[model samples]
Target chain A: MKKLKLTVAFDDGDYVVYAKLHYDRAPNLIAAIEKVVPFSNPVRHARICESEWMLSTPYLGVEDENFSYPDPGDISLHRAGPHFCGWYERISPIGTTDIFASVASEDLEEYRKKMGRAWEHPGAKMTVDIVEVDA
Target chain B: MNPIAQELFETGDRYLMERPEDIAAMRSRMGTRGQNMTVQIYAFSALGSSVDAMYLLQEAVAKDDYDFDTVVKFAVDWLSTLAPPADGSQGAAIIGHRASVHYRLDQLADLTSRASAALKQATTRAEVREILQALEHYYNQVRTWIDLEFPWHELAVKYAELMGDPAPRPAP
Candidate 1:
């Protein structure tokens, strides 16, 4: 069977995280996410949520002019491996941050926890609000 | 042939005769000039992978009741981080010579937008085929760029070293 691919970019006023996903393995990954949260039409709402999520953690902060998205030429779908992959940059504060601690330890873990709770009941759709932040 | 070129040819010939999969594996292993080549290959590989992923999602959207927005976002989120390890000054030269990393990122964003649109409207098989074909073309272009930049011999030597063998051919 062929694989399914999707890409996402989050502009948090100061930074952008570009990501790609393989849908074949994670068919419900996105829907599962939507079930937990709703997308705010304006980008800033999500930004604030991401920021709030980061702020709650000691290791996370918004950086200046360090934001980045994926290189256009660098897109692809691997036959086997992680379902998704991509790069990110700090846009506002400008500096390198620890990936394991900032993303894996704090943000991703939090997301997983929240998602778990939202998914506790079958077919429960979580409402996510994305409010646009001023650039 | 240039010394580097000659070594690459010998290495490739030896690998073809004895270790074919090793040749492919060499492309993935990092370090030295081979790592540089691998980065270039990876840049292209990213494109091919993106296309493959996009095609898959398009197919799913067509036949299944999937959340299109969520799926697109999921794909984009992953695509944004597809980078080779930030080592190798040699590879940096190649990547910079082509364009700064930011340029590549912009291109990816544009492609993602296109893919998102295609997915949103993907109701027929032909449209999906077209999107996949476009991705295949993008992949081919990346391969061509790699070929032009590294040629076969330098790539072979790099591959040989990456495979943990001493430079496959003796110095001229």
Candidate 2:
């Protein structure tokens, strides 16, 4: 099976990072995310969970699957706000989440800086879409 | 110690016991069916209002000399307003059946207790402001829980009058 990849672009593609979909662990969530690829939304910082960006996805209808504490660069779907979360920096576990993808390790630093900016200056636009890549 | 700070400390201590009791009583009343959804709606309104109150408090603290006595007085007054009258007046009642609410309130008690102790030691405006900031952080945690637990738009629609219209108020 070909592993899926997602492109996360911040500020209208000014900063871009690649994430690999966890097809094995969260196949259903991955499928749900696929349907919404090429999506754009405003991103905000999380209040409880430190060093993370929350992308509102009120449209998602998936349930919990493989929910657990996230490491840096992990992307997960949190059904409460129905937020698509991106953890760019190490964060303490507020609660478990159904992770579907993770940013490339090499891109973690830049991703951390971009997501951290939402703390000081929120309402930045983030675009997500599937990308052709071998992982 | 400033008299206002002393009063705030006392108020905080009172709330550590009173607020949770109010909610627990509300939960008991709710279980009896003596009260209706109106009580829960009012309780939700109280929770919603706290978010606004925190924001206002934050603004007041931003000023260098923002009248500490007035701020303390407001804080003292607002703490009481969170609970409905135990006598069940004005069609209001407190509501908290979910263990999460009780647990969160316990966490809130810790913050208040810390704030009260800090009140005794804080001699400078900056110190007081820091205490307020800590309170704001705790409020934010509760706000997050509320957001996760309840749908504000649905609540606003169902209890339109109690929830108040979401008019565009000027930013604080």
Candidate 3:
């Protein structure tokens, strides 16, 4: 099986998250993302669903955008910038995004809880590093 | 005015007024999905407002859904026939420079080709829908591009004259 994955390491690389790019489903987005391998960012946590879901908008200069209604653990690529919105609950975007990747390894509920608890500490931040996860 | 140009003006106006409102709702419900999808949809929806009637006719008459594929192939094939981008800051160039447009359009071509390939291999409806979402977004980009530079007749004529390809065929 062909597996194309990205490692999103955060919190000083302590929390390692692995996601698989659905190249077959979102070829344009995957292709655009593949060009900019090793996309990483450290941004203030802005909870979208839980008290922990990180909202990041790192511009990767890619133009392949989409409207993606994703389930829990799915990651969306915003239109212009390299924004990320990870779904952590029974939630769906009112519209859609370039839903390019999915978090397959980590437990969504657990990740959310951990992130929620960690966020309680003042000045808590999440550094997300997305790199190619070779299979 | 040609029907294409007329339609473009009318279509663009409708979306320009309507989509912005939808954007807020979408953003509120879906986070950045609103921020991203609305920009894409409105831009294209505006452009689709004024598509070339002939192209629309072709799309209507065609037996297969080759619209996306055809558009991608045209953008790529036409660009390949020209010289590569010249040296300079990509942003420094005039917003409407042929080379600059080609540079970005080339990227757009790659994006569309990838989407087309993915659609061919997609299995589930969910997968197919996402692929379509991406395709429509990019496809609108080309349209939005046109919408930005309205009165395309001048641009079209100038393109023909500069490229010296009066008979350059567009993909069907």
Calculate each model's fnat, 2 decimals.
Answer: 0.00, 0.00, 0.00
**i-RMS of candidate 1:** 24.8
- TM-scores, each model vs. reference: 0.29, 0.44, 0.36
Off by over 4 Å in 1: A1-135, B1-39, B65-70, B78-133, B158-172
Q: Rank the candidates by TM-score, best first.
A: 2, 3, 1
- Candidate 2 lDDT over A30-67, as tens digits, reads 78877866665556666567677776442344557896
Q: Among these predicted structures, which one has the highest lDDT?
A: 2
Tens-digit lDDT track of model 3 for A74-95: 7776543124666645554566
Each model's C-alpha lDDT?
0.32, 0.54, 0.41
lDDT computed for candidate 2: 0.54
Among these predictions, the greatest TM-score belongs to 2
Instruction: Give the per-residue lDDT of model 2 (tens digit) for B1-172.
Output: 4443344334433332133343444444342346534445554455546545654664575576688767755653454344221222313312332222332244344344445445444566555654554444334334333333333334445565565756321111
Q: What is every candidate's C-alpha DockQ against the true complex, given to 2 decimals?
A: 0.01, 0.03, 0.01
lDDT agreement of model 1 with the native: 0.32
- Candidate 3 residue lDDT tens string, B1-172: 3232233233333332123232233223322443333344443443343223222322332334545455433432322222122222122322233211322334333333444444444444444434333333333334433333233234456778889868422211
